[model samples]
Target: MKDHTGKPVYFDEEFREISLMLLKAKTRWQIDQLKQYADEAIIFIDEPILSALGSSSYLGVSETETARLLKELIDVIKNEGGISGIHCCGNADWPMAIKCGPDIINFDAYDYAGTLALYPEEFRGFLEKGGYLAWGIVPTSEAIAGENPESIRKRFEQGVEKLSLHIPKDLILSNIMLTPSCGTGTRTVEETIKVFQLLMRLKEEYA
Candidate 1:
């Protein structure tokens, strides 16, 4: 939707057209997911640019407006009885995503978890309201080669502790899901396989 015109639609520029097209296409995608998954699928709306919310590139766009745009897309998934997960794996304006009311807030917990800890009150409110947290604990970078299950698990523990400042650990854990720090499209096949295995082993250990 951002490239509906064969060129990028700058958020600081005229983005209303791109926004509308995205909303329509997103709603259609949700409808298709419901038809295919029949309520069992958690439809993810991937908008990586959202991480740029507070940057100079998006200076013309207000945080409130960003939340409104996200809500417009997220509501499509929620209305269909599907869990809506919004991911911005980079250090983003966490409060904006939280304000959008996604069932899950997926962030780069491996590196930028502390950025989220800054919003203890808002995150506590989100968690207290039964929102889920998709902690991207496993490394997706070349560091994946050096990381093992124990190290990854320790990172998760530290992140959860930072996040659990105002919320109960049990509540946070109950709603948590582990994932890579970002998508594995850029990773090697063998590396991706190892990433999965490491996390699975960690899960069994915790289980």
Candidate 2:
């Protein structure tokens, strides 16, 4: 890969190609599962690397190309009668991701809720077009120990309020879906259970 200055950058194109191949295979398998067993499917493309798009380490990464790649996969899912979502567990260029046209955007609302609010116009358009926001309010880290249902609800409301500055409060509220800040793979089973328990309680009390 080359940067804007025409200097070669470190990017393993072969690895990227293999990763895309794997992603496509997984996506197709999920679509087949939906067709065979369920009436609907929601597939989220977990893209943690997206958070590093504009960072110094990945300065040569092309936003346009990234969006095209994401859109390509999302379109395949959508065309196959599945709902496509993108989950980025850290702060990223919200506008660029929004423009990729996924049915949902899963974000780490527990930590980076305010980061998304910085791109009001993009969000407004996304919401108005029947898009959904998967608010990752339940923290998956050690912080989950300190949070209760009410506290998490309060934090979620704060995030909604921030976005409501540009979009209608009701619109934002109605379109929101709750999730953990990220996967609980690294957490203990006890902590993982606590995360889901809190998630259900928060949904029952507030959602």
Candidate 3:
């Protein structure tokens, strides 16, 4: 993935797009623009395609190269004295994310906690290196139907139990941040507020 993002986009076997390398220069240029309006201390890179890393359509893509591309963007945030966090929001390659050495890895832990549970060693290494986990444990969809702060906390406990097998419970809890499964792109304003409310309550309960 080099920075020259041009005219048309390309796709891989599963029909996922792997086109766009995210060059270091473009990252620096773009982040410099964002710094004017947002806090530059915690610049997050949202790369949905990171989830398509090893998919059929992306077979030609080398994992090492992909990590390099990710590191390029991360280095930009770091150079700016910012914490670089990447959000995939899917059950993608966790090890790849860790190898890139991001300060935080955000994922849809609501449904994919088990997916991460499979990579205990890598997960531990990432945490040990001071990498934090923004566990998206709150559901943003209709699955939120019967859930409240209390119920979601229980769900979180069950999920964290899997990760705690390889890492300590206190360590996992200390480095965790809660988030919704994904953005409420189509949710009503009231529903969106409810997500935030649940998050607040969960924070209090856990705190």
CA-lDDT, candidates in order:
0.80, 0.87, 0.78
Write candidate 2's Cα lDDT for 51-156 as tens digits: 9998898788888879978988998888888999999999887788888889999999999999877888888889889999999999998898899878988998
Q: What would the per-residue lDDT of candidate 1 be over residues 27-86, giving only the tens digit for each residue?
A: 766577667746456877777888787688867767776677778778777876667888
Error of 3 at 187 (Å): 1.3
TM-score of 3: 0.82
Model number with the top TM-score: 2
Question: Model 2, which residues run further than 4 Å from truth?
Answer: 1-19
Q: Cα deviation in Å at residue 83, candidate 2?
A: 0.3
Q: Which 10 residues in a row give candidate 2 its minimum summed lDDT?
A: 1-10
Number of the candidate with higher TM-score, 2 or 3: 2
TM-score for each predicted model, relative to the true structure: 0.86, 0.89, 0.82
Number of the top candidate by lDDT? 2
- Look at candidate 2 and tell me the lDDT of residue 97: 87
Root-mean-square deviation of Cα positions for candidate 2 versus the true structure, in angstroms:
4.1
Candidate 2 lDDT (Cα, whole model)? 0.87
For residues 97-166, could you state the per-residue lDDT of candidate 3 as single tens digits? 8887789889888888888778888988888778899988888887877688788888888999988887
Q: Candidate 1 regions off by >4 Å?
A: 1-7, 10-15, 30-38
For model 3, where is the 10-residue window of minimal lDDT? 7-16
